[model samples]
Structure formats: C-alpha cells, structure tokens
Target: MTQVGEGQEAEESAPPVMTFGAPTAGEILAERYELVEHINNDSAGRLVWRGVDVVLRRPVAVVLRYPGGDSATEMLQAAVAASRVIHPNLVGVYDAIDEDDRAYVVREWVDGQSLREQVAAEGPLDPARATAVGNAVASALAAVHATGMVHGNVHPGTAMISDEGRVVLADARTDGADSQENDVRAVGGILYFALTGHWPHHEAPLHGATAGHGRAAIPDAVRDGSGAIAAPRQVRAGVPAYLDDLTMDLLDPEIAPPSSDVLAAELARLDIPADDHFLESAGTLRFTAEPEDDRSPLAAAGGRKVAIGIAGLLAVALVGLLIGISIFGGDDKDPARKPVAQPSPTAPAVEDTTPAAAAVRKLDITDVKIIDPDSRVRDELDDADKVTDGSLDEGWDTQSYNSAKFGNFKKGMGVWIDLGAPHTVKSVQAVVSAGGATAQLFAGQGNFPHTSSGDKQLVKNYQPVGDALEQYDGTTMTFSNGFNADQKYRYLMLWITELPQKEDGSGKYKIGVQEITVQGS
Candidate 1:
C-alpha cells in the first residue's frame, strides 16, 4: 500500500510523459483539481498523483489510467457505482471522469502509510492490532458486498491506515478480474503479514508484492502436498491458537469462506477495547492524582487536635536540650521561638471530566398504512401495520417482481405514518430486515393515502428530508435543514424505490422493513 507523497515520485517503467498523457505539475483537470506531482504507478498501469481540489481547498488523490479500452470503461463504471455506497471504513470517491483514451478518479487522500509500509517499519504487529485491522477491512467489504457489488481489488496495497489511526479500505477496482472469495482470502493475507511480516499470496495482482524470483520475499504459509497452506502458528511464535486457526481457515481454498458481514462480526468479537482515534485526541487513557476539593477536609478544630499530638512528641524529644540551655545561660538567651507545624501540601490535580450525551428514545408510530397509490399490490396492503408491531418475525413486505427495479411494472411503494400531531423530528431509523433495499424519507402535510405520486396534495405540501439510502439493512438518517425542528409535520413517509434480490434466487426481488422508529419530541 505504498502512497506517493508530495515530491516522492514512484519509479515508472514507462516514460512519465507517455504514461500520464503529458500532464505536468500545476495542471488543472475538469477545472477543479490541480495536479501537484506524480505519486506512483499501480500494477494495472494506473498513475496515482497527489492533487488539490481548488473548489474545496482540500487534498485529493487522482488515479489516471490510459488507452481507454474495456478497462477504462470498467474503471469509470465501478467508481460511479462505488460512490453510491458510503461507509465509515470505505474511501470516498469524489468524481470519476472518462475521456476518449483515458480515465481518472478523484478520491479522498489519506495522510498515513499503507499496511505494507507499517509492517516493514514496525516489523510484525501483535494479535490484537492485526485483528483490529482485519475487522475494519471486513466491515468495509460487507458494505460493498451488500450493494450486490464486489470489491475486486482487496490487497495489502488497498488497506490504508490513516494518521488518525482509522483503517479504511480504498481503491475498489471491480474490473471483474477477481471475486468475493478473493477478497476474503486477502484478509488472511493481512493477518499473516501482521503476525509474521510476510505475504502469502504469490500471485497478487498488485505491484511490489513479490521479488524478482516470482515469489513473496517472506512466506507466511508454505504449501503442503495436500494443497492446504499451513497455519500462521507453524511459522510464527507467540501467535494465539484461535487466531492461527481463523487465519488458516481463511487462507485454505478447500474451506468455505464466510460472508463479509459474518467475518466482520467474528473479528469484532475478538478485538481489544482500545481507542482507535489516538491521532485525533490523546493516544491513550491515563490516571492522575485527585484534586484537593475531591477529598473531604477536616474542620479547623480537628486540625488543631492533630497538631497538638505531634507537639507532645516534640516536647519530650527536646526536654534534655531545654534543661541544658537553662542551666548554662539562664538570662543570656531570649526564650526559644515556639515550634510551629506546617499543613500538608494541597492534593494533586484531578483528571478532566466529560459529560455523557443524552440517549434518544424511539417515538411510537401512531398509525402505519400502505400508500400504494397505483394499487400495484392491493393484496399486501392489509399487512402494512405489521411494520410497527414490534416484531421482526412478521413485518410489511412488498410483492415480488421479476426485476430489482420493480420490473417497470408500477410506480414506487412506501409506508406512510401519522404522528397524531405535529412534532419536531430529530432522526428516522429503519431496520430493513433484508439486503438490497433502496429507500428514502420524506415529510409533508398531505391528505391520507394520495392516489398517485403526482397527486396535487403531495406536490403542494411534500418535501424531501434525507437523501436516498441504497441497499441497506439497518439505517439511520438525521434530517437536515429541509426538515428542521421549527418546521414540524404530522405525516412522514418511508418510500422504497428499489428492492433487494430474492432470497430464493428466483430472479425476482422484494423489500422487507422489520421496523421503523422515529426519534423526536
């Protein structure tokens, strides 16, 4: 995962001028991004460069690959598709552009080294750190796979650790050159690398993965006659047995690979409860002495009593000195100054305190109704209330259609809710129950169950609250300026524009919403 920083150009096998289409430093693209310097060339011959977004005044990484053929077309399409799915662990794509002979993708720039670099400098990492990295990458893959898409490029080069200690998987190259299984196997490679400082994949598609002899410089797993790669514990000491088995299972092709979602959950269970935002704030939690105010102080009278006890001991120790002084010089010396005691120093300072945030309660849905204006599926209309019944076993579902986009058979479908009265809404959370459902939220002061999408009442009163959430199972949306607190509404809608693939593989699709909870006053 080598990144070309400013002024650190990567070695180019082909002439720079020819590979980059003669673009020079300071050159502007699409009248927005300004190229600063060429970073490096990927195994696919894609030229990565450091650039700046003039409009946003932010740093960006631009990947450009030339001789647009099927590869260029696939790159641009994949970039556009990947941009539609957003998750915290995935790199954000800003723009994807295609010219006649070239294509470029502008994306968020990470300010840190790659996993490969991290391992190289720090040697092998502990089991906990390796599991944490695996969990992050798996989580990102789950989000990608949920959209019915594959992140064809999952390698050490794509796993990035930012300066903020955030691990994100970047550069989703869905060129159909790889499969979901390959992504799963790559996680094993990451773990093996973290524990043994080696890469097990000899045929990795990325550059710099192997030495001149066509083999990984450091081999984490050596193949046996049975074609099963040995576990990490065989090669590295101090590796936990559970982690070793998990890594071996992931690497062995004979063993079935778990889905991204399942893998993410398993790794999360094994992860240590340490902060991942060490770069954003203090790296770790620490203890400090308590402040003086934190302890109960005794009354002044109590302090005098303790001092008197100490004074009695001092008087006995000084008795011999007092007698000798009085006999030697009765009137020569003035009376010795009375002994005094000092109070204890103030207590040490206490650690800073941060207040906890208030919890958001779910608002009850007063009434739920099927708002199928076109009467697309009158059969399922009676089951609409099942969505708010607080039971996942039985909930509202759309009629199955041949295509995910409703087979172009009817207009969109949705569930409308009545709050009983106007109330300021804060957020809307939905448990989709199934994958591949694309939905959105809207608010308005409309009459109940309009007949059509172009109904006069809806057109005059309805307004969109949050943007579309594509292919999600559980999603939460906080309304923005369009649905502010001051602009309260009694009616809300959860509209479905697309449905997920059929669970039975029938080439048909349906949508299931187990629950819908609104958080507001």
Candidate 2:
C-alpha cells in the first residue's frame, strides 16, 4: 500500500512548475496569446518575445517588463499613445496588458532586421537607395509629428525594412520631452549614417554610437573649433551635390530643421523608383557607373559640328578631283600612278626606355587597432596586436557559436585597421586563416570614432577600394588606377561578410586573421 501511494505522488508532480514574474515558452498571456520564443532584450531590460495570438491566429511580438511595479508605467503609456495613431510605416500595437506582477505589450511582429544590422553586414548603400530609406522614415515621422507626438527613438536600430520591401520605423519612446525638431534632425542623422556609416548627432544615446570609454565613438558634423562639418561630398567621393546640401542643412543648428512633411517631399523627389519585388530582394538601391564614352548633350553637339565641317571639306575636294578628271585624259596609260609614303630603313624608330616602379615596402600595422563588426563576445578582442605582429601561429580569432550562420543571431563580422593618418595606399595584402571566407576592402577618412563594424558610415569620407576580395591566400587588393591622388585614406576596413567552417569541422564556423600588410606611398 505504501509503494503504490508513492508512485501516485510522483506521477502527480511530473508537470513543470511555472515561475512568478518570468514567462516560459508555450505560456499563454492574457489567456489569448501563446509565447513561442524569446527574441531579444532591449536596452531598458524589457524582454522581446515572439508570440502567437491564439484568438486571431496571427503572429505577434510581445515586449514584457517583469516585476511590473512602476517599470512598465512608461511602456504602457507609450503603447497607448502609439495605438491612437495609424500609419503603414508604424508598427501596429495589437494589445497592451498590465498584470500587476508582469506587464507585456503585444504588437505586430516585423519580418526583418534593423537598419543597423543591414548596414553593418552590407556596408553603405548607394546614394539613391540611402535617399529612399531616409524618405520612408521622414514620411513616417511626418505622420507622427502631425499627431503632436514625437518618435524619441529614431535611429538605425529602430529603422526596419520588411522582407516584402516595405520600410517601417519601430520603437517610439514617447517621453514627451524630446521635440519634433530632434526627430527631424534624427532623420538627417540616418541619412548621414547611411552615407558615411557614422551617426551625426552626439546627444542621441544609440548603441555602437559611443566608445567603450563612454566618449562619442562617431563624431557629428560640427567639429570642435571648426564649428561646422564638411559637406557629404567632402567626406565621401561619390555623394551627389544636392543630397549633400540637404543633409548638411538639417545637421547644422544654424539652419532650422525642415518640417517633417517638407523634408519627406524633398527626399521623395531624390529617391530612385523601383518595383516592390525588386526593392524587396535587392535590399539596397542600385546605381550604375557612367561609361567613359557616354557624353553630355553639349559635348555631343560639339562632336556633330566637327563631323559636319570635315564632311564639307571632303565634298569640296571630291568636286576638284572630278573637274581635274574631266579635263585630263581618261586613258589608263595616261593616268599617273601614286606612290605610298614609306620610312627609310636607316631611320630606326626611337625605342622608349622607362623603368617600372618597385613595390613599396610592407607597412607596419603594429600600432593599428583591430575592429570587429559582428563580434558577440568583445569588440576589441584580447591580444588583437597578434594579427599585425607578424605571427601566424598566434592571431585574432572570432568567438565560437553553435551554428555556422553566427547562431543565426547577428548579421556578420569583420576586422579593420586605422593607419592613424591618411596614406595613398596602392594595394593591401591579408593572410586569412579560414578557407572559403568572403572579405571586402573598404577605405575611409578616420575623422570620427568607430566603435564596431556597424560604423560603416562613420568613415564619412570613404569608398570601396576594389571588388569583394578574390584569391584569399595572402590576397592582394590593388586599388583601381593605383595611387590616383584622390584615393588617400587613413582607415582600411577588411570586413569579412561570410564565415568559414572551424578547422575541426564541427559544422560550426568562425573567422581568423593572421596578418595584414598595406603597401602604400
């Protein structure tokens, strides 16, 4: 009888116990939605979870702050206010629940990553594409501003692009203290970051915007003594003039920020048109380089005039020849044979002699810092100098993750070198540890603080040195038209967008950097 009673008690306690203030997977919230998985944690310590609305049978994201207390008061208020306004670009709020012990806000789930992730992985977007992203955010802000509300949190981290090519702005922190002007200016910051890979405003507390020491990792347009920052064209090589003017105006405090509506209208005009399907897969806008033979209208007209002049001279010479033929004899014997011009054998062609330049000595990168864009552990890894210390056995390696796809967590990773000062680099050579890894060489002006690989635009004055790296064994990336005076750069970022398998073949992947050598004048 005692043994049978003990077995019954064990069977009764077989189910798992639910913890207070903490929700687990498959748990139902408000008895209407089921939590699927934990997505991420925001800066405010709120848990963002992927959930399903059992009643409506739709997917949702639930941002919950445990031990509700007064911590969720602000989140609840912001959700209520955002619910009042309706915009396609705005994330829809499904429901807000305040359980005294735990508070959760259920909202529409976005099927995409943040703009910060996109830029970090793919580098900067083309001018037209960057303008399109700016325009979408501006349009959304115009609506929010119209409601007498402000999107206090408007940065690359909050800007989202859907898999269907729809642009949406998420996470509006409605504190009522941040002004509409600040929101408008943030749109300019987005354009600046999109163009230069650096945040323009120093006041905005954005992730990866500040350094580990708590200083502005990326500087704004205004220089300390200089007062104002240079135009986008001055920072970047291919920025259009009109776009540069608009971005500078918004960033400059002297020039008042344009109304969200007005700014949106102007950006729309500059944006390139694309079908929804094309924009969806392309992710960024595409622009083609103009061919050398393609000329402007004025140049084409001048060429036509030169051709007409030559045709007139040829016609006159033909008429004179006809007159001479009619007056002269028509017989073949009477016609004089013309001799072709030829050079005498004694007059030898002058042979030109010019020695080709010898390759520059390998640069010393020992003083340079190694930057990782998609690092999960530490931004500046331990013993980073090993990569430049000329040691193959000991070098920089990435943190090991579960899956080959970075655990399907972050975008990608890379390593960069700041030369301390600008140099006319002719070519770059790197010895990577992993095989089948894809790397790209990017050049930029080291005018701002770049905390991580996400600082793609901070190199405000930057350009791609060459195509994505090819032939990875001590790959040599020679800048096109080597040493064209305009190619001087202080920073060189070798971003590895893809990861190769670990040497042990555990079906997991990470990257390793052995040595980096830059040959420049």
Candidate 3:
C-alpha cells in the first residue's frame, strides 16, 4: 500500500485545487480573507481555500465560487442553515458570506488531510482505524441529523481525521431539499470506503468481485432500495460476523443505525472474541476484512463456510473474493509447482529495482542464532530475538508503513537464505523440529538479504514430498516436504512458531534452523 514518500498527488484530473480557476496561495479573499493554500474542488465549481479571516484573524476554510443567480443564493442559504448545528464530530461554521456577486462558506480549518489522501499514500487502513473512524463519522452524522439537518454528503472526501485521532465531518446539506435518505446512504458509503479503501458508489465489489458485478444477492426486491447489496462479510472474508451482521443490519431500510452513542455502545459489545480483534489487533478505524479465499481446490472446498438468507448469493461472492485472494496470498500449500522436467528460468531483478516497501533500518545479519535452551514459544513483539530463551532486544523498530519486532512475529514470520540461482523454483525443504521448535516457511520472489518492498512477495505454502509433519512439544513441531523444497531461488522465510516461554516467569529458548536447503535444480 505505502510506496516511497512522494509529494501530494491528486487522482485523475483533480489538479489539487477544487476550484474553477487556479488561485495562488496568499491571494486576498473578498477584500477581507487571505487565501493560504488551495484545498480541493467540489462537484460544483466551488473551491475550498484555507485562509485567515483577516478581520477575525482566525483560520478558516473558505468555499469560494463566483456568485451567479438563484443557485448561488440557495447554496448560501443552505450553509447559513447548516452552520446553526453544534456537534463535536461536525465541523462548525463561523460565517457564510454572499458578497461581491460571489458566495463563500467560512468554517473551521481542520489541520489534516481527507481520508482519501491518506488512503492514496497508504494503500488501505488497518481495521482498528477503520472502525474508530467509521464510528466517529457516524456520530457526526447523528449530530447533524439531530439538528433536523442532513450532511447530504458522507463520502470519504467529506470526512477528516486528525493525527490526534479526532473525526471531523465537512460539507453539509447544500441542496435545498434532497431526501434525508441521501445522508443515511452516504453514511453507509463512508463506512464502506473507510473499510474497503474505495468509495461505495463505484459500483464494484472493491477488491474481490468485478466492478458493478457483486456475488452477493441483489434480490429483485432489494433493487428498489439498499436491501440488495451483499453483506460486508461476503465482500471481505476476515470481517467479523458481528460486524457483517451489524453493517448489513444498518443497510435495512427499517433499521436506523442506532444513534451514534448507541452505535458506539453496540460496537463495544462486539468485544474480544465477539469480534476479530481477539484473533488479532487490527486497529480502531478499520473498514472491512479482506477475503480469506486461497483458491486452491481445497480453499474452494474449505475455509470458514457460512451462508444465510442470501446464502447462494453470499456463496458466489465468497468464491470470487476467495479466488482473488488465493491467487495471491490466501495460504494454500502447494506440493507440485515447477515440473521435475527442466523448465525456463525467470529473469533477474532488473538490477535497479529499488527497495519498494519502507524498511526498519538497513541491517546486514552477519550471524543468526535461534535460541533453543529456553522453554516456550513467544510472539516476535515480545522481544523478537527470543530473548526469553536468551536475550531479546536490539531488533525493535518501525518503518514508514510497518512495525517490526524481529522476535515478535511467530518464528515463521519470514525465512531468508541464499538459494543460488534464478530458475523457476518448484518446492522448498527445511529441517524443522517441533521438539518445542516452531518455524513458518513462506514462498515469494525477491533478493533475500537486500530486497525492495516491491520485491516482498507472498504465495500459498509449498507442496511437500510426503505428508511429513511431526509435533515434538507443546511449543514445537517438526516437518519436511508436506511443503516444497527449493533448489534455485533468491530468498526463503522461516518464521518462529515455537520458542522458550517464560515459566514461573522464567525459562527461554528459540527454535530455528542452521541453514535452508533447496530442492529445485
């Protein structure tokens, strides 16, 4: 998702300014305000400018557009009306001016980028972030609704989340009278975008199904309203069932997503095991779960299978979502990859493929030791170096996009070793012992010791020779070709699954290997 840092970029033809004509920063506004910088343009030719109200000497976003006819007066009236509402989540309006044959709505200037900007910079948001943000926007909507006003627009562009974790709703009912229904639907749209990293109106299944063609049901009856859209779970697999259930429930025409406070309370009920947070800590402002479909014939027949009233429809969408995920990293172990018969060797790394993903610090490991004398397996985040078995420290850091606790990940987080060639690799082999030792092997393409973020690749597991997995201790297991053994490749990943745990608040050990051995010729 995150690429090397670059300057601000706009989508398609947005031009960074939501204006009819480019107005330079510091330009005097309406003989009173001073334009600081350009923001974005709205559907109408109106542009938002961050400037200081020279008279008030306060920061404000000024919506500037040449005032024309009845439409101009009407937009001004809508602003005048919306600015009356007061709410923490809602952006407050300070003034609305109909001056010099032009209209401008003056409001508090939030010091943050829109969610859209954040997503473009960082592919998708972590789930926890999606929820917290979604809930906050929902609260903003409720506050707007409580004042007998509707936001009218709830797209990602209208929601702003400051770095401090506060949510602010921008843009309100500019239309004289569009049904309040639009505001509600917009909330749904906002939540969808926050979760999926794409707007809801695009008419596509975000990541899984084809655009405009979703696998979930749009029963003829649902076509009349919001009833037909597939459930979030069907669209994104890892999404918790409660989330799916609640999100889908909100889509019901009869059910109003309880008031924002009520909604927050409901979400709190979805605690721990009740939600996916227990499985892992995704984040507070997450949107939806990515599908867990690893398309191996088994993923087709396996994985968690659940279908309800829209059973058949959900099933199809899942198949498509799973199919897409499986193609990449759905976690299927392949036994036969390259044929035993000689095949073509893939090309080299282009020699200048820079490190694509961000990194912790560039470090060359001159030595690696998997602690074994200790007694339990621990998460990499604990000390990443299996310090329990030995001493876990010195490997803690955060890159621009990801955080790494070298020893915090399961021993199987990644495996890196020289494979010696560039041929199409078939299988991989590791002398893994469970005698309280756990290691995870992953297959991908890229330079092992020095690779680019773009080089980091993930695929299903390797196909082994025989089903050779043997468990040794509570924290360890041993195995061979139930996965593949590689011969000629660039890198390998051996993550930690078992290591010495602290017993009586004591004891430590780490399970790893001396070196990786490949099987591909």
The parts of candidate 2 lying over 4 Å away from their true place are 1-20, 207-228, 272-521
Candidates sorted on TM-score, descending: 1, 2, 3
Judging by TM-score, tell me the better candidate of 1 and 2: 1
Worst 10 contiguous positions by lDDT, candidate 1 = 278-287
State the TM-score for model 1: 0.48
The models' CA-based lDDT, in order, is 0.67, 0.63, 0.46
Compare candidates 1 and 2 on lDDT and give the better one. 1
List, residue by residue over 258-309, the lDDT tens digit for candidate 2: 5787667556645636442211122212222234575754333234445656
Q: Is candidate 1 or candidate 3 better by TM-score?
A: 1
- Could you give me the TM-score of model 3 versus the true structure? 0.42
Distance (Å) between predicted and true CA of 455, model 1?
A: 44
For each of the candidates, give the backbone clash count. Answer: 0, 10, 84
How much is 72 displaced in model 1, in angstroms?
1.2
Error of 3 at 509 (Å): 54
The candidate that achieves the highest lDDT relative to the unseen native structure: 1
